[model samples]
Target: MGQPLAPPPVAGDLSDRLVATDVWTDGMLAEHGIPVVDVPLVTFGGGIGSFVTADYLRICGVPTSAIRVLTPLETPWQSYEYLTTVSQIPRTERLRSDSASTPDNIWGFPSYALREGLQGDLKQLWNVLVEPIWANYYTPRAGAAFTAMEKEMHRIRYPEMVVRGQVRMVRRRAGGGYFTILTPPQGAAPTRRIAYRSQWVHVAVGYPGLKFLDDLQEYRKQTNDYGSVVNAYEPHEHVYEKLRAKPGVVLVRGGGIVASRVLQRLIDDRDRFRLDTQIVHLFRTYTATPHGTGILKRRKGADGWAYQGFNYPKSVWGGQLKQQVRKTEGAERARLYKEMGGTNTPVRRDWQEQLSRGRAQGWYRVMIGQIDRMTKTGELVEVAVASDQGPQLGSFDAVVDCTGLEADIREHRVLADLLDHSGAGRNPVGRLDVERTFEVRGTRNGNGRIYASGSATLGGYFPGVDTFLGLQIAAQEIADDLHAQGFGSKLGPGRSTSQWWKWFRNQQI
Candidate 1:
């Protein structure tokens, strides 16, 4: 067996002390001299999900002062941009996300295609119009999405509400509301932790953290050499740079989008620099045909990737699939989720052509198996694979694992605290359980409601709960729930139109 996994770092001593308390009273906090700031809403994990919700509330006439976004990120898209860039999707590259899933605009009116068309990219518009039948699905550029979100961020005055810190845990206040503890960066504040008391708490902590495979972790721990075995999410630019300097063989593990992008990057470098680089792709499950539960839902599959336009079937956003999932619960819902879930990537022609060329030239090879063991042997690494053809061994300059699986929610300090002390339970699929309105079902404290979006709350009611469109939908639901409770103005046609006009004019609210 591989080396046992190491424990994650604790949030802080404050988290240990706070986890035992179910409710915190004003007197209790006052005794410790902890400053408590009051706000109508407090959103943690200030990524795209938090930004979308804040944008919705702002559009509904909520003031910046009424909301507090507690996060450590310098910018809303900083985490997302980092992941994409390290995974080979530079600012110039297009994301696999759908064009119409605009996080900046809730209505998704004048989709990315229309915007690109007006900007003189008629090819994009045409491609979107024809879609799967004629042309491959179109996606917005990584930079374009970030640029749009930045514009929305300014229009909503998101910067004014940002509290730069890492959230420890949220505790229910004795009287009402919730106390969200934030640990500000060193030198940013005098206090060790600041507490924000809010009637509504929104948690959008995107993916708890990345999980490197056990074997890879074991190898790194034993040899203390991180250069040979690396994860795609982390910075491994040195791998490519070294390849550019000299001929090398790269063993790429996993068959997801990151794998395809890494392969493309390697091929591009090979063609551009006239370098002799060989690529070996390892797939756990190699698919050879279309797959799905129903005839109408078949997804294209070849080699290993289960190809789809988006992460989930587009129908999950609004059609029958959405309704089906919303109505089901427990085992049925989990079954449906399993049917829709798989590692998939959009079928891009350029990448496919490059792979075809690599195959024809014999520089690229596909292997069906997983790395059983990896050992550093001199300058190269020896990788043992347990394949259908029996045990196989290979030596490569570097082994890049592209399996993009996030660690368990419990790995996140705040999430773990929520599960242990805040009455937040796990859903059928083991993530945070949430209501239809994206509210943590049992996490209501008095009149206050705890809402959540993003990856942490997946498997509740939506299949695409982690996507851009999914986050927007969750934001709308949470906003609507808040509006019902008289927190913000109703975003009816008039308000939506006026705010949309402001967005169009690039005017800050």
Candidate 2:
């Protein structure tokens, strides 16, 4: 019942569009010198992953003001929320979760929704809804929750000391600790000559950004126009906007969650705005028919998941296969990631039902195939699809590639440099190898630990560490590690109680 998530504004002047402009200005940079100041801890990626890490460190007694959340900040989930909600992740959509999941709200405190419910007649529902109790990962408006996490970052003051910049590179200090170099925004130069040296560094720059398929990447490079074709994870507003302007079929390429959400958005627009947006979903695998029986229905689809499971499959969560994954490494890990959760699929049921009805009604159709060639003519795209239907031919108004995402560490210069020059190593899954605690695993070049979270750890040992809850879990682990090493303990249990009494004395709710 909260505000519907705002559709992402088209990218304009980025300076004007992004929030917290003051966090990274030339003046502040000019004010601080290159004098190597030593801080107890540092975390990578100024997103929820780092936010939670900082939060836990604060609770553990490290002054909230002591930690530096190093990264650019438009907001946590800034890109992802845009990708999901604008595409098809709706506000009311129910989440497909691991049964017990919370985003960065890892302390199991309440959100606006849970808090509101706590004051209602359905208080049982409220407590039941509270995560880590009865509620597993069935998230509601998961996208909204992600945006809400930004408020947590601000509320807890994690961003109080945010350095508005991307970490360009890092090098292990000769004696101990590490130094991280950064690239501030285009105009923020006076501070450009600054570096942060710390005893600990936690890397969470989630999967080296985005890696589209070779064919899709080639197509995008060739077209350089996102008018008729678009990648699901990026700003491809023109595709749907074009469909809105001219009513024709939108061929969504992928069998994953993004594809599902994109299709739903098209359907909703078609129904609500009266846009004649027909949709043709091109899934490489034909799942129009159920293939398995029992509780296993969610596993047999592909990737060891029951054909009915959401986002890879339920088994990816603590099931037998997940345990097997823990035992396996190298090619096995890569194969596991490929099989489970590698594909994108929306995690809502009503959308699935809607698409099913569309299939029944003919307004929506499904073709299991891959695109062989795409030629855009005037207002339409001639698509040659390779399918069991004997090489089907179709013309669509636009194609949205929801082919999921992959971020090769090599693409991220900081990680690559660390791997090559700084003595870091890739784990069994071919990512920045880190211990279970989220510390990047390589011979100790210094006391500072380089860790990663988000999509980068997709192939790591933890089950759902790549998701929101996973981010918090990684943060908790990192905070615990830092605490064990004696740092970031501002809000330990004692301090938390003190704050509670302070709130009570203020008569604050």
Candidate 3:
């Protein structure tokens, strides 16, 4: 996590358009006498945002081979999978989409749960309650959608290479554009720097990787149980595997979306695998008075929200509150955001019913407090909770924190270097602050146009841009920028009937 890397010695310089037009790749170009000037549309986080942008670019004739999706092969939904399929994935977990959130089509294929109702059953119910048309926004099967994206990867053969090295930094090239440096696997010295010089640089480095608390990091710094105590997002196969072997008390922290999903996942395990798992949910907010009005029980959690809102009520999305938030500053803005919401979704009634049933059954319960300390017992964990009643001690066979994901760009040294040397500055929201076009707002002397999108840009002008729709919107804006710069033409109204039919025929139902 240092300054942007110094420019690689330019042996045989080349242009970006040449990189795009070539059947010869970076590997092949070097094989010949030509140098591979990496294409401009290099997307760092090759998740949905990258996929949509790459897909649009490809069909619009921006040959898939030119776009390099530089990311770990794990799909964008890995964080999501751990919560939904708490035990094993049930194909039946219907998506809660409205009529327009289908993954099959980006721009036009806006089908909802109800649209799938024409097919049949509990699914139809899913459509009406979850996927009805013009209904509230819903979350689709993030995993399945990501799987579908991988297929698109194969179809387009997007970019001939995905260098395994992690980017440490991206700096402006001596001549123009930007120069990205990567840290290869442990022992590779020769190819330490994989230079990507482009006219336009997209820093779509999604949400920063998860960064735990000082205590957690301190524990990790001191001992090795860091693996035993998992960050809610990372790989924790052992936690579940352990639960499978023995039925014991598992403590779950946080009341956010992940917490709720994790709760259901535990319940799913109980029903599917017949594991009589006991769970305790730790919530910071005690329902003194419901936070919502009438039917909407707007109960606040922790620092904000007395009722249901992502972090704030929907009114914040469309009403005067958004403008008010715009005028706020410093602690006021943070307080305003706090007053709105964090990442918690409303307690979906279905999941709520399941938890309620579990509580009635005596298998599930809740704790109103926060973790004050932790110590390892022989085969369990000793947790001290700071409750309103007083300090209380509890023991758990395991602890799963449903705290959401919040990563810093510096988690990877290469990206850290990019920020240090490339002149990139964070936006007001504390994530990558980019211009309207999604380009990172680097210093005036900063190399090439480095833009960021997806969760990283949530602190930007648009709200909910971290969602799938947001990714697509960012891609469209980025693509428009590239098009204006003469990268290529975007496919729109001018399509022939045959081509339109071809695009339509390829959609998912």
Top model by TM-score, which number? 1
Ranked by TM-score, top first: 1, 2, 3
Report every candidate's CA lDDT. Answer: 0.89, 0.62, 0.58
**How good is model 2 by TM-score?**
0.79
Per-residue alpha-carbon lDDT of model 1 for 338-450, expressed as tens digits? 98888887788998899888889999999998789999899899999999789999999999999988899999999998998899999999999999999998989899999
* Higher-scoring candidate on TM-score, 1 or 3: 1
Give the winner by TM-score: 1 or 2: 1
Model 1, global lDDT: 0.89
Instruction: Provide the clashing-pair count of each candidate structure.
Output: 0, 35, 34
Query: Clashing residue pairs in candidate 1, if any?
Result: none
For model 2, what is the C-alpha lDDT against the true structure? 0.62
Question: Model 2 — which ten-residue stretch has the worst lDDT?
Answer: 11-20
> What is residue 478's positional error in candidate 2, in angstroms?
1.4
Q: How far off is residue 398 in model 3, in Å?
A: 1.1
